[model samples]
Structure formats: C-alpha cells, structure tokens
Target: MLDPQRTISALRELQRRTGDAQGAQRVAYTAPWHAARGFLTAQLAELPVTVDTDPAGNLWATLPGASDQELWIGGHLDSVPNGGWLDGCLNVFAGLEVLRRLSEQYDGRPPVTVRLVDWADEEGRFGHSLYGSSAVSGHLDPQRAATLTDREGVTMRDALAGIGVDLQHALKAGTQRQKAVAYIELHIEQGPVLERQNLPLGAVLGTCGVERHRVTVTGRAAHAGSTPMDARQDALLVLGRLSQAVYAWTAAHGGVSTIGSVTTTPGIPTSVVETCTFTLDQRHLDPAGLAALWDHAQRDLAQFSADAGCTFAVSPLFQIEPVPFHPALIGACEQAILDVTPQAARLPSGPLHDAAEVARAGIPTVMLFVQSLGGLSHNAAEDTLDAHLDLSVRALDRLAERTITWIRAAERHGARIPAAP
Candidate 1:
C-alpha cells in the first residue's frame, strides 16, 4: 500500500511549491514551466525512476517492470492560471504512489510493466490539453508544436528548448507500445456529486462530451439614443435574446449550455451595438443527445439572425464525444472501491481528461474519482478529505493486486490479457 503520509507530503510539496506561482512558478513554457518541471524532477528522485522528456514537452518517469511491455498511469502537472491546488497534482502524486508501491512490493517483477508519466501542458496554458499524452497516443504533429505559444509570445518550441526538448522530439515517441492492457487514472472528482452522495470514492459513470463554439451576431450600428428599438436592428439586443434562449435550452435539456463570454463593440455601451461575439458551452453524457442540442442551437442561431435582420457566424471551437470507461476495468475499480471503503457512488466527469486521448488510441481505459469536498477543485480551496484520499490509495492497491493476478494467469497461457477493445 502507498504510505498515506508520504502521499500527503508529496501533494503538499507540489502544492506548496507550485501553487504559489512563486516557488515552482507558472512554468507556462518560456514563462514558468521550468519551475514546475524542476519540482517534479526533485520529487521523482525518491523513487529513482528514469525520467525523460518527450518531443511534445512531456516529462515521463518510467518504473521498468519485469517485461518490456507496460501499464501506464499518467496525469498532467500543469494547471490553469492561478488554478486549484488539487487539479492536476493529485493524479501525479497518485500515480507516483502506484509506482512506489510496485517498487517496494513486487521486487521489480510485477505481473505487468508499470510506468508513471507527468504530461506537460495538458492545461493548454500554452495551447492544447494532453500535449504530452497526445504525443504518446500518436495524435500530435511535430510541426504543430512550433505554432503553439504562451502569453509572452514564446512558442512551445522556444519554451521547451531551454529544457532540451523540441517538438520533433516530443512527437516521434510512437504508438506501438500503446499496447497497455489497461490504463487508469485517479483524480479528484472536481464536482460535488460524490460529496453530495456522501461517498468517499466511486466508479466513474463516464466522461462528458463538450461542444464549444463562437457565435457572432451582426446588426447595424446607429446612434443609440436616436434609433428606436422597434425599427433598429441591434446586434447587442439580438445577443441578449440569444443568451436567454441558451439559458432556456439548458433548462429544457437534461444537460447544460452556457454563454460564458460575451462582448460587444462600439467603444461605449450607450452607443448602438454593431457586432456581438459570444461563446457557447454545451455538455452531456450521450453523444447523440449532444449533437442534437448542437443542431438545435444552429437552428436557433439561423432563425434568430433572420428575425433580428442580422448576419450570424458560428465557428467551431472544440468538439469531443463523451468517453465511457471500460466496463471490465471499471468492474475491477468498483470491486476495489468496495474492498477499501464503505461507501461508493458512480458519476460522470464534468471536465475533460487524458483518458479520452488514450481511449482514442484503442486502449481500454477507466478513471476513478476520489471525493472533492463540496466538489471543490482547481483552486486553493480544492480539497479531498484525508480519509477519502486514504481510501483512494487503498483502492488503487487493490486494483494493482487484482491486475497482477490476472496478468500472471495470462502468462501461464502465453497471453497478455483477455481481449480488450
């Protein structure tokens, strides 16, 4: 089992050092990623795992198993600007705990090889989540790395240059070894569902798919005080109606939709609104349902534009389908949760994660969520109860043991695992 004290200490150090935006620094490429990477380098030394930087700026810690093949556990170390304490740090430490246990318990000969990866720039602070993980899954283009930049106008190329890794280096890692029988991640629930359910931990029901887009409504800009509302085609007015429709749609659907960012131009609110831009965020567990809502929004956009005598432009922002955890892997996690804790619940992830990238590579993957108090995460206030964290560690141990048992049995028959995918 992972030493709860050690895991807690590791987490504290990561938080104490990095969250401050001082100790470890922001490490956003040319800005502050070094401080972040520096802290990881220091911490992984305790385990003596081989750490390497991939082309896409991923820092990987490999704990060699008895075999060449492996089971990989990963989480990003990057955080949003002034982000939460638990966001990416918890998973990194949790995976480290798994590695620590493997080294101590199995004599470097676990049933399957094990690896712990610390993905860089998963937050897209430099643009793109899973930049590190995506490289491993064979999704990133080496050239695209040069195009990504941070706030200071430093391309990912230049930022990683100081670290001795370029995009060409991060991208060629290859996918043949994506052969892990199963990949798992443990993370704070990032929502209040588990806490509301009063469960310390739970199986992930699924990850929600998100659809984001930019909508521009254009209407004539005229003298604000002179143009009457009944006669004038005001873009801001149309946008207001659009926001109301979005809110109504979210209320009507089982899912949610939001226009988080909106802006109008004229240099003054008192002047007639010429153009308006807004963002729409929609998410749900069902892919078809998400698409239907997306289509619904499109229809609304068209009709609203026509009714308001305005021109509308909708551009795709981000689109991803919901990813369901592997049933078999989830079964192991479910049983492990029950073995380690008294209460367990299942819920969908509201936020995106690396698992979706790995799943796209044809690996059977599952995620486990530890309780986040009040569903609080991504900030200094983000917290998972100590008891919950203990239970979570124990559950990971149980999962590792069960996986070893299955892996060893497979070796007896000259196979790696029962067919997944």
Candidate 2:
C-alpha cells in the first residue's frame, strides 16, 4: 500500500543531515539524534497518535486500538557511527507505514493498542548496546553508571546530561510492562545468508549470545634498526597470531566471531611499537559455547604471550546470553513471510538488536528480517531492494494483526506474562 523507496530516501536524508565525521556519529543524546527524533516526532502528528518519552529516554508514540495500553510496534532509532540507512530506520518507518496503511485498510483499530518506540542508544555509543531496551526491561544495574565512558572520556552521565536526560534514572531499570501483548521488530538480516539464498523475507530464529572483550598486548619498545627480531618483543606479531586463532575458532564452531576494532600506539615508522590493543567480539547460539571459548582464550593467554614474546590479557567487557523469541510469534512471522514472499526462510540473527532485550524483558517478542544486498551493515553502502522492504513491512503488519488478536484472546483467558524477577 506504500512505496518503500520514498521511505528509504527520507531515512537516508535524515542520516546525511545529522551524521558527522568526528565524535560517535548518530549516538544517543547527540545532535544528529535530535534531528532524526525531531523529524520522527513531527511525522507522528499526522497519525493522530499520542507521544511521550519514557524514563530511560525511549520515545513512545501511541495509537489506541480496541484494547488497553499499546502493542509497542516500533524499534530503535540510534545507529552505529556512519551506520547504513536501513538497520533500525526500517523498523521505525515500516511500523509507521503499517499504522498508516492499517488505518486506510480497516475502518477500526486492531484488537489491541499499537505503540511506536524509538529506543534511545540501542547502539550504545558508550558501548552499552541495548541500553534503552535493557533499562526498560529492568536488566541494567543502577550502580554500573560509573563504568560507562566514550573515547573522549565523556561518561554516560555527561552525554545524557547534554541531552537533558538525568543519568540517575537510567540506572533504575524501570517498570516492566505486564500486559497481554507481543513485540515484533522488523530488521535487515545484516548478513549474506538470505541474499545468497535469493530470499525476500525470513523468520527470525533468535538473537545469538554475545561475548565481547578488550584484549591488550604489551611488549617493550625498541629502536627499529638496532633490535633484532629475536631480541625484540613485538606485540603486533602476537596479536596477529591471536587474531587468526580467534577467527578460526569461531568459524570452525558454526558460530560468528571477529576482531572488529584494533588499536596501536605510536604510528612512527622508525619506532618499534610499544603496545597494541584490540577488541574481540564473539557470538554463538549457546551460552556454554561462549563460556568455553572465553575459558580457552583465557587459559591460552599466558602461553600465547610467552611464545610470541609479548604479554596478552583478555578482559570480559560484556556477555549476553542468546534469547529465543516466543514460538507462537515466530510461527506468525513465518506465516506472514509466506504471505508476502514465497521464498522466505528461518535464520538466526548474527547482529545484536533490541528484539533480544525485549525478549529478555519477558515479552513474547519476535522478528522478521529483510534481505541485505551484500549482507553488510554499519557501512554507507549497505542496501536492500524495495521489494524486500515491502515484503518485510507486509510481514510485520500481519504479525502485528496476529499478535493483537492473540493478546486479546490471552487476556480474556487470564494468561499472564512470566515475571523477569
């Protein structure tokens, strides 16, 4: 019922107007976010919806249905530095389109309320991924506020303060909604599986577990010309071998892993490198595998460093266990995919998203993934065709309808959401 091409252009422009080469671009509480947030809020007025911001800075736009509260139909709006257009933008815009189209298609609202959410800082510019979603889910510890920092040494307190959000509240992990409802987040697959298979849409299996760490390699700096290879403790060589081992392990395990960022000191050509550090991000479908990997990596650090003539250490930055979306919600997504495109399949998510946090919050949440052109994201070149976008929006609309109906039925029968406590 809508041209997704226009929506994509509008979204891309929103990014262009706000992103910057410096600072964490498009981060929460940043000027770019303000620009995008302002645009989105202005758009909400057309739908005759009521809007408000939550304690954790999550912006909520509500369209009332026959039932109580809202269906919470949207997704995060934050992005990685210079992230692609479709990542979280698709969810927010597509959900808006769903509401608009639903208004035109059906004379009355669906059986339940619908809520559009733009969760703050889903990218966690301060490295708190799912920050907003997790805060609302009562998952973030209030005392951990002191631990977060950006590259410029700006704590979450300062960054949030710049946006007029109080850091103290961000710690509370506020009220969990206990309602007769389900959540459906539509996102790009961010991987090559669907595109390689020529699939237009797919059902989300689940969000994978994540183990991210900061590994530091320390070695003595020496004069480049004077020190022989045998005498010098070169950190880069040790890190190189460590990187290869990490990549090979994750690849062999049917999971995913990578060294996403690398940092080295003193870029002088003549100076022997004194220190080099790197960030290792590892993911898997099971917690046991993650733990095993972490254990092995920790155990190997001593010998690996000794053999490579450097000192290596692995510090656990963050760990999130894999989360399964509700089975019924998943089934509804499958049916919706079949309705829109015949070539849809089920695949687990490699990239972490808000759906994982929502699922952890005890909501019966599920996701529908559109095919990415080259299975690439967090890049300017990431893309998906309009057909795929249309397929995703249609599937999400179907999911919203089914979920609303299910919620109403469940409420009538006194079904309850299990408490996160």
Candidate 3:
C-alpha cells in the first residue's frame, strides 16, 4: 500500500539534507549534490537492490524481476543554482518511494524488473542540460561535452573526473543496459496552471520542442557623444529592434521567446557597442510550428541587422524536439488522476525533462505533475501544499500499479502498446 505520510517524511529528509534557507543547493557536480547522492545511497542500503553508477555519474538502483524487461522510474537529482527543494529532486525521491513501497509489498522482488535512476546534471552544472538522460538515450556527444566548462572555468572533463566519469568511456557506458519497456516520472508542476485551476495534480501531454541560438550583431564602435546619429552603426540599437521583433513574432505565434543573456564589448554609456551578442531560447508544443517560427525569426533578425548596417551571425545551440507521451501510458496516468482528483487537467510542459530523452530512446514514457504553489519555481519559495503533495503521491502510486498490470497483461497477450491518437 502507498503511504503518503511516509513519502512526505522521505521528501522532508531529502529537503533537510540538500536544501537550506536559500533553497535546494544540490547543484550538479557540486559538493552538496554528492552529499545528496550519499543520502540516497544510504536510503537504499538495506533494500534488496543492486545499486550502480554510470560513466555519466547517474545512479541506478535495480530491483530484479523474473525477466530483464524493465519498467524504469527516475528523474534528475541536480537543481539550478539555489533552485527549489522540489524541482528535479522530487521525481527522484518519488521514484525512491515507488521502489521502497514495491519492495515491501513484493518482498523485495517484483513481477517485472523495476529500476530507479538519479540522472546526473539535468540542470547543466557545466554549461549544458540533460547530460545523463541523453547519455542513456545514446545522444550525448562526449567529445563535444569535453570542451564545455562551468562558470568557474572548470572544464566538464575535469569536473566529471571528480566524480570518476572518464569522458572517453561515457559513450560506451549506455550500451550495456537492460531494455526499458517504459518510464514514469513524477515532478512538481513548476507553473501556476494547476494551482489557479484549483487542481492538485495533472497528466502531462508532452514536452515542448526547444530551439536555442546565439545571435551576434556586429557594427562599428564610436564615441556615443561624438558619433553622428545617421552615421553610427550601433549593434546595441539593432539588438533593441530585434528584441522587440522577437517579442512581436512570439506574441503572434503560439510560443515563448526569451533573450536569456546579453553581452557587449566596452559596455559603457560613453561608447556605441561594436558587437552585441545574445542568447535566444524559443519553445513550442508543435514541431512543424516550432521550425517555421525559428525560420521566420532567423530571417527577421538577419533583415533587422542588415537594415541597421550591421552584420549578423547565428550560432546553433542544442535542440530537443517535442516529445509526446505514450498514449497507453498517458491513459493509465489519466485514469489514476481521475481516481484521485476528478478535476485534474491535462497540460503540455513548457520546460523540457529527462522523460523527453527517455521517450526519444523509444521507451514509452509519461509524467505526472503536482501543483506548484503560486507558480513559483527556481526560488526558495517554490512549493506545493502538503495536501497537494499527498494527493499527487497517491495518484502516482496508482498509476505505477496500473502501468505494471498493463505491461504484464501485454506481455502475456504478446501485444504492443497502442499508438498515440
């Protein structure tokens, strides 16, 4: 039986260990995250499970079954800088609860192999995101990641070395693994949608596609006071116009566009910027729409730069296409939600997740989201009501049970899961 109080107690313990007054400090590749991992290890110490770590520093604790076919449950253990106590960590701890509960009910062995994972560096401690799940999906390029360095100038290679992950062998690590039949993740909503609707939890439709770019506009620098207004080719001015254009485009299209960072040479009021660079992060739920939007934005930015007498350059960043959840699994989750909270809603995730990577690996995947209080996230105040937390846990446990039964029945009947509608 699922124990809501027990689950909350475990979550509280994790919070105590990894979170402080400032919030969760278990950022990936940091000392606090290692301590958090140690705490997880201790929790699984007495359980009948074989715990292991991959070359990417992802932790896996497996409960053996009759066959190698596995139902995987996991989430990232890492958090953003001073992020909430229950961002990536919530799903990881929820997976732990599933393991603990199932282990007790089944006497340490389930009918199907169940594996719980703590994905490493999902918050991109070393300048990129989705490190561990992408590695497992065979999409992580170790050679490329090797060149990445943290804000501290610490190379990803060196940072990984601290955790015993040899970058050269990272690619080979994912090759030797059991076949995953499905993956389920439980996470906080991280938005206000559910809370505003007075719902405690929801079933995720899918994660949005993301297109990121580094845009650079080059213009001649000059003294701000002395340069003639008509003769000046100020990159900063071009940037301002392009930023507004981006907002306009996104407002018309159904998506989000953010200029996350900006930089300029000789950043002073006395000088016109010679070069201006900014990061563009765009996301949409529809794949084709996302591509079209990006194409339009790129063309607009190029034109804007040319009109301002500035040269334009676009540097492609990483991209993850929209990933829809498995229809059968989503149905299972929806049923579980309905059983607990009949008013629960179905929503698409704007933020990406490790589940997207897992789905890309061709495993059936679904996610459950608990409401985030006041839509607050990435801050110390990020939280869910205790009642909502309990409701989500119960609902997720029901989904897990339902999914296991469905998988077992499918295996017996020699049938494949239904396709998404």
Write down the lDDT of every candidate, Cα atoms only. 0.73, 0.76, 0.84
lDDT of 2: 0.76
How high a TM-score does candidate 3 get?
0.94
- Which scores greater on lDDT, model 1 or model 2? 2
lDDT of 2 by residue, 1-421 (tens): 5555656666667767765443225667767778888988888888757888877788887777777745777577777877777778789988888777666555536566777889888887876688888888877764575477877788887777777677678745356365525788999888999888888888998999998888888888888899888887888777777777876666656677777778776657776776788887878888887776766566666667888678877666666899988888788788888877766688889788888888887778889999999988887777888777766777888877777667766667676432220
Give candidate 2's error at residue 270 in angstroms.
2.7
Best first by lDDT, ranked: 3, 2, 1
Q: Rank the candidates by TM-score, best first.
A: 3, 2, 1
If both were scored by lDDT, which would come out higher, candidate 1 or candidate 3? 3
Judged by whole-model lDDT over C-alpha atoms, candidate 3 comes out at 0.84
TM-score of each model, in listed order: 0.88, 0.92, 0.94
Cα distance off (Å), candidate 2, residue 347: 0.6
* Candidate number of the best lDDT: 3
Spell out the clash pairs found in candidate 3: none
In candidate 3, what are the lDDT values of residues 173-216, reduced to their tens digit?
A: 57634477888999998888998888888899999999988788
lDDT of 2 at 305: 81
